[model samples]
Target: MKATDRTPADLLRSALSEDPARPLVTFYDDETGERVELSVATFANWVAKTANLLQGEMSAEPGERVALLLPAHWQTAVWLLACSSVGVVADVGGDPAAADHVVAGPGRFEDGLACSGERIALSLAPLGRRFPTPPAGYADYAVEVPSQGDRFAPYAPVDPEECALIVAGAAYTGAEVVEQARADAPGLDLTGPGSRILSALPYDTWDGLAAGLYAPLAAGGSVVLCRNAGLLDDDALARRIESERVTATAR
Candidate 1:
């Protein structure tokens, strides 16, 4: 399938069925010179565990709002799918005061503490390590997620028409997100299967989320998500392209 147009959860299932070993997301941190690659199965495992924590531990349900305060990182991507699986709204960079749940990285821990209720913190550290101890009030994501079951079966139905994403003052239903990606794919020139894309666009904007996250996944391709892309010199960028076999780039 060149592109599977559906909800994020369905896209993941389709990708896994086609090829579990296929590289789904390659993450790079130019400033830290760190590299991590996740296959379809591996990424799905992360999603399931996180979803379990959200649905079972945090009591996340349909219509609940999750304020995502993390930056453009692999874990952030995992949260996007996790929320979709549990049928919670992913409010990216949303107002914490208005949220039911909050996921923050080390950088935003202080501000996230003021959120309405429920708090999860990601170290965003290498290998997803836990904080030394739980934060003042927030639960350490790394500490809690590991104990959750590997399998995920949502207790309630997740309607495709329900709002799954709310970002930058725009709301998108689960179906709308998939449809939008399909509509924008041709214009973005994302053609054929196994196309690898390197993207530096931040995920806070609609186009940024489309190009960096959705478009490639919709096209049955993969994404090389880069944080601190501006730090990479031309030679380094070219080297990454050659090494990762990247087919396209958006910065």
Candidate 2:
């Protein structure tokens, strides 16, 4: 399917149905040096379950802003997909003041955010830690939500002209640009199963969303998010490209 032929949710549905066992995301933690893999089927189920929880349990109205302060990892992708599934506007923001709801990790920023009324906190545990019980205030993301099981909610018809994401501008700009650069990039093909991508950009930034996330998804390609190009710069990037056999990348 062409990038312009479908919405984000449409592409996700197609991907989930294509190969359930295919690896959708490969997460690597720089702090502990560990790798976690989430299959396309499993990730799709999680997105549906989380979307249900967000819409049913949390009572998050459609078009409501749910701020995500997540790192560039597999969970971020799942959350974005979940929000897209439920029609909730997932605000990937650093500033907590502008968000209606917030999902954060264990840190000063997570603890500092004030929770008023029936606010929900989706917290992540330390890397490689066994599933922990949900505390009085916070909800453990892995444990609290039940798996969507074999069934998934049917995809709601979406208007192609509607806004899907509100990605932050790169550098600093007052006006937000929402063009489909993925459709415009020349020589971009996502028809093969082994297609791979390497991205060193931050997820919250516009370039990262367009290149790292949207482009690959539009092309049905697997993405690898890296921290940096390493000390040797081009040499490290080249090594990664050679090792992963990346077919395409955005500089």
The prediction achieving the highest lDDT against the true structure is 1
Q: Estimate each model's TM-score.
A: 0.96, 0.76
Residue pairs that clash (backbone atoms under 3 angstroms), model 1: none
Q: How high is the CA lDDT of each candidate model?
A: 0.87, 0.59
Question: Residue 158 deviation, candidate 1, in Å?
Answer: 0.6
Which candidate comes out best when scored by TM-score? Answer: 1
Q: Report the alpha-carbon TM-score of model 2 versus the true structure.
A: 0.76
- Name the runs in model 1 displaced over 4 angstroms: 1-5
